[model samples]
Every structure is written in C-alpha cells, then in structure tokens.
Target: MAQTKNLEVWLRGPLPDMPPLLQPIAHALLQAREEVQSFMQDFPEELIWERPAGVASVGYHLQHLAGILDRLFTYARGEALTDEQLASLYAEGKPVEAADQVSALMQQYEQRVDRALEQLRQTDENTLTETRRVGRAQVESTVHGLLFHAAEHTMRHVGQLLVTARILREKTQA
Candidate 1:
C-alpha cells in the first residue's frame, strides 16, 4: 500500500499561468486529479465495470470525468461540440474492448485536465462574466460559471469514484 501524502493540491501553491480569480478552479481540478490518481493506483481492472449498490461503476465515472471536462471546456471557448465530442459524450459509461484499462482512462482524464488548465491559463479574467452557451440546448452561462462547474463536477464524480473504488476493494479483500 502506498503511504498517503498531503492530499491537498492547493498546498503546492497556485498553478502557473492560472489567473488569480481562477486559482480556486485550478486548485479544485488538481485536487480531484490527485485524489483520483491515488485512489486508482493498483485498482483491479476486472472491477472497473462492476456496479456496487446499483450505483454507477468506476469505469463510467472515469470515462464521464474525461468526457465532461472536454465538453465543458469546449463550451467555455464559445464553441460547439464536434461530432467526435458528441460521440464521446454518448459513449461515456459503456465499456469498450480497447481503452478499458484504468491506466488508459486515467491518462485520458489527465490529458483532458491539461487541456482545461491550458484553457484556464489563456482565459481573460475580465471575460469570465461574458455569456457562453452550453450543449445542444444552448443554455446560457458565463465563462466563470463553466469553469467553476468543471471543477465541482469533477470533484463530484471523484467522490463517487472513491466510494465505488473503496467498495470494490473491500469486496475483494473479503
């Protein structure tokens, strides 16, 4: 078992290139990533798609985490989802033969986070209040709203993943 470290990503200080107002957003994202990575270390692949207590499986949460971040970041850029993005969104929870491993999913999520952080770096704090549209419904929101949502949503899924992962581990141990 790996020894638990400080757990809080914010204690490392603000991310470079992230705007002041967006520091919390970056902190939340980094925190989620750190927790997810640690919690997933050495996790069994066989249980990735196992649903415990009728809740979503760990695989779904991992895939959704990456997909949601990609979609939210795309919206934050005042852009629409491309066909590829739409396909990815539609396929979030379902398992695929390839790319089903925990490491692959984690790599995808880490890459998405990198992209989101890059977007945050380029975001003009002054424009955070500017209106942005979301999804095919084109719901109204602001840049700040989207960014904050990305962090909170990521954390929410992280929480679910943690619980599910723990349950799976306990079952295996038993």
Candidate 2:
C-alpha cells in the first residue's frame, strides 16, 4: 500500500512474486486501497459512522473492508473463521468509543490489504482450481472464485465508501 506512482497499479506492471493468473486480483485490491486512501484523506472523525441516507456508514465500510478480506482469505486457505475473526465480524458497524476512529480503521485496512497481497503472492496458480468452502453453510467455490470475489467485493465497498465520504464532507462543509 506504500506504492508511490502516478500510474494505476495494473499499468505500473506485474507485481513481483505474484502468480500470473492472480495479477488482476492484486491490481484490483491495490487500486481499491489507493482509492480508499485518497477519498478518506481528510474524512472527519465525527462523521465516521454517519449514514446519510440510512444506508451503510463509512465506518461500517472501513471495518468491512478489513474484515471481509480476512474472512475470505481465511476461507481461501481452507479454514473456518476463528473465534477472534467471528468476533470482529459481529462488531463491524456498531462503534466502540475511540477504537472505531478513522485512523485505526484505515490502519487495519492497510494491514489487511498487505496481508492479502502477500497471500496472493504465495498462492499457487495450480491450486486455483481446487474447491474451497465459504461461511458456515460451507458453500463451494474455487480458489480463483474466492479471490476474485474478494477483489470484486473490495471494489464494491470502496465505491460505497467513496460516495459516503464525499456526501458527508460536502454536507458538513455546507
């Protein structure tokens, strides 16, 4: 996430050590991270949990960005959600005093992205076709499907976060 360049990540070139088939997933995650960083550069602390139109709060999106990655990555590893992970999931939207602040959430988010990228780098393309289970229902998906969904879901949430932040800032300024 410390990448400093004018070009988008994908255009910047292939990520080192990342498998060829997983390159786009890495790019998408990186791009989503950058967008979150940019949009949240000056996001106000007081507005972190504001749900302007009764939709999801910015805080929820931030917590979700990190939590979803952790959950999906855990599934990709052929594992179930640990106690701590399940606890984190339950605490997503409801604020906990100062801990839900923007900086802390962003830090968690950056760390998750870093961990996700590293996992992608270590992912063997040959294993992509192998089936994996998701959530308690144990729904089936391939490694590639799960990872690709992670990227897709990341981008989707980022879009929501960006718009929510923009609306909050604009309304507050006016």
Tell me the tens digit of each residue's lDDT in model 1 across 2-103.
333554777667778789999999999889998998899999989999999899999999999999999998898999999999988888888866654788
The global Cα lDDT (0 to 1) of model 1 is 0.90
What's the CA RMSD for each of the models?
3.2, 2.9
Worst 10 residues of 2 by lDDT: 94-103
lDDT of 2: 0.93
Steric clash pairs (candidate 2):
none
Candidate 1 vs. true structure, TM-score: 0.94
Tens digits of per-residue lDDT for model 2, 107-161: 9999999999999999999999999999889999989999999999999999999
Q: Which ten residues in a row have the lowest lDDT in candidate 1?
A: 1-10
Please list the residue runs of candidate 2 whose C-alpha ends up more than 4 Å from where it truly belongs after superposition.
1-4, 97-100
Model 2 TM-score relative to the real fold: 0.94
